[model samples]
Target: MLEAANLTKKYKGLTAVDSYSLRVLPGRIHGLIGPNGAGKTTVFNMLTSLVEPTEGRVLFRGEPITGKRPDRIAKLGLARTFQNIRLFKELTVLDNILVAAQIHKQYGFFSAMLGLPSYTREEKALHHNAIRLLEEVGLAGLAHHKARSLSYGNQRKLEIARALALAPKLLLLDEPAAGMNPNESMELMGMIRSIRDRYDLSILVIEHDIPFVMQLCEHIQVLNYGQLIAEGNPEEVRSNPEVIKAYLGRSAEHA
Candidate 1:
């Protein structure tokens, strides 16, 4: 559902991302993996329109979406979560999700001042939907709790919940398991699978946890030194000599 062609990004003397091309099919979890500085996050930023690519194009459902503003891309059914958690610390979990849902509504100053029937109905529906989303992510019980009060794992799930409030066709998740313990990460893996199936989503996940990616994603793409070094199924990617030598490396010290 999403295709990137020869996508490249550079910053002055450094080429952060090389000409990389990949496709994400509907209802599949595609994994993007690399060592630090492989430019995986740069690729995510370019794809999500947060950073303009130095060269190449990004197409969503066959239409060019490169160079669009982040909000515009979001309105076109692409949503993302950051590598680090981004949430309103003071807002309640439910309120955080409600804020995201408001993007889909037609709210204006006059509508709010006059309390128009349409605006009221939309607001009510947004609340219900936000609660539902929170419930889906296992945070409904903590809806009224401040975002900062949640545990680290719950915070990650809340981030996902907030992203789902945008109703995206394609979801870009950067390191969903980044700071989680083993149990939390394993729970996240199950949640990812469940949500992917439940929403019929096309997901692109950039994760440093190799075993998690291998076990969860249908296909894996490997990058090293800002280049697409390997792209294949888990087994093929795991056994690839170049991938092993470049990414995993030969010696135990390298791993």
Candidate 2:
């Protein structure tokens, strides 16, 4: 559902992402893996238009969206979560999600200003949807709690749930398992897979967690020195000489 063709990025004459390309098929999980400085996040930024690509373009369902603004991209059904947890710390979990669902509101300004029945109806629908999303992410009981009071892993889940408020066709998750312990990570794995199927969406993930990424994604793309080094299923990537030499060994042996 998403494709990046020959994407390249340079900053002050240093190339960050060089001709990186990958495809995320419908309803499947695709992985982007690389060592530090490999430009995985740069690719995500380019796709989301947080950074313009120095060369090439990105396509969503065959439409070129190379340099669209970040809001435009999100409006067009591309949603994502950051490597670092980002939440409205003081807001309740339900409010955080309600904020995101605003992007899809349809009532006119006249309706809003007049407190017309239409706006009120839309507001009620959004609130219900937000509550449903919280439940889907396993935060139903904490809907009224302040975001900052949740554990680290629940914070991550809340971010993902908020992203879902956009009703995206493609979801990009950067380091979804970054801070979780083994049990938490394992739970996240199942949750990711379940949500992908439940929501009927494609996912592209950039993660340093080897086993987590391999086990979760249907296809894997490996990067080193800001270039594509290998692309295949889990076994092919793990046994590839270049991947093993560049970063896979350390990843495999990592606790």
Candidate 3:
């Protein structure tokens, strides 16, 4: 579970996020949506410690993690994917996941250099787990292929797979459906649900795809001009007057 209190971020004259607060319960999926420049990504950066907040704090499972290093936060069981795909283009897909799985290494570098039994054993286990993670995201068969060779949607899934290698308790996904076609988006929705149930994960996603968020998230929060405008179930948010006038506007009619 994660909780953010009065989170605010400013860059010189601009307040990117203003007093935004929200909580994600265990094993639940939550969505954050807003117009461009609404600071959705800024909130994520603050939560992950990629950027320090100008004010307020973040709690992950009750411990404050506001200024912790991103790797430290990840080691504590939080992982995230970027809006733009970030993959090691030249690495084999399996190797890309193997890189993330290094967090679970139980042996020292000397052990690895000497090919000690402990290092070999742990490395073998990580390989097995990486393959299993790739399979879960429907990319097992492409494990040996170069990461840059996958299709756009498949690349998105690969990023999620790499994040899963971290074995996170909470996952923050930024625009997971950004470039997917309708069919791919639907597949991703199903995959996300399966992951939540199978991994017992709590997900907080920031997505511009309205219908995708509406169908995937159990709870939704709307932001506009760096301020929270609405928070509710999909139906409640879809019908809220303030949300209609703010982020959704005329799009609400189609939504």
Candidate 4:
């Protein structure tokens, strides 16, 4: 569903990402992993157009989307959640989702301001869609509750629901397992798999959770020092000498 070709990002004296490329097939889950400075996030930023790549282009379903604005890319069926949970903290869970659902809504200012029939119709549809996403994310019961009132796990789920509100064909999850307990991460694993099939969308996940990524992704790509180092399935990546050496070196450095 998505193809990144020769993606590179250079910041004056620093080359954050260099000559990286990967393919995300339709309806498949692809994973990216690397040690801390491997430019995993940089690659994601380029894909989503958060930051322009110095060189390289991204194609979504064979259409070039390189250098597109984030909002434009979003409207073109690409959506993502950050490594940090971002939500409308004060808004109700349903409201938070409603905000994202509006991306596809065509209710013009005049129609909404005048409460025209068209606006009303669009709103009803949005509400229905929001509720349905809530149910799918297992947050139906808490739709009316303030987002801040939910526990951490539920907050994470709420963010995911908000992203789903965009009706994206490609969902980029950045560190979905970050800051979650074992139980929560395990639940997220199941949720990711379920959504891939349920929504019929491709997913590209960047995660530090090795086991989770391995089990969740059908294909994997590894990065090191902002460059492509390895790419394969879970077992193949796990057994790769460079990947092993990188992790072991990281462990030793921390020790």
The candidate scoring highest on lDDT is: 3
Residues 1-255 of candidate 4 have per-residue lDDT tens digits of 898889989999699999888889999999999989889998999999999999999998888999888998999899999887889899999999999998898979999999999999999999999999999889999999999999988888888889999999999999988888998899999998999899998999999988889989989999989988788989999888878877786442343
Give all candidates' CA lDDT scores: 0.92, 0.92, 0.94, 0.90
lDDT of 1 at 98: 88
Alpha carbon deviation, residue 71, candidate 1 (Å): 0.4
lDDT of 2 by residue, 1-255 (tens): 998999999999999999988888999999999998889999999999899999999998888888888888899999999998889999999999999999999998899999999999999999999999998989999999999999999999999999999999999999999989999999999999988999999999999999999899989999888999999999999888889878745543451
Off by over 4 Å in 4: 250-255
Model 4 clash pairs? none
Cα RMSD, each candidate? 1.9, 2.5, 1.8, 2.5
Work out the TM-score per prediction.
0.96, 0.96, 0.97, 0.95
Expressed as tens digits, the lDDT of each residue in 76-159 for candidate 1 is: 889999999999989999999988887788878799889999889889999999988988989999999999999988999999
Return the number of clashes found in candidate 1.
Answer: 0
For 16-75, candidate 3 gives per-residue lDDT tens digits of 999999899999999999989889999999999999999999999999999999998998
RMSD of 3: 1.8
Better of 1 and 3 by lDDT: 3
Candidate that beats the other on lDDT, 2 or 3, i.e. the better one: 3
Q: State the weakest 10-residue window (summed lDDT) of model 3.
A: 246-255
Ranked by lDDT, top first: 3, 2, 1, 4
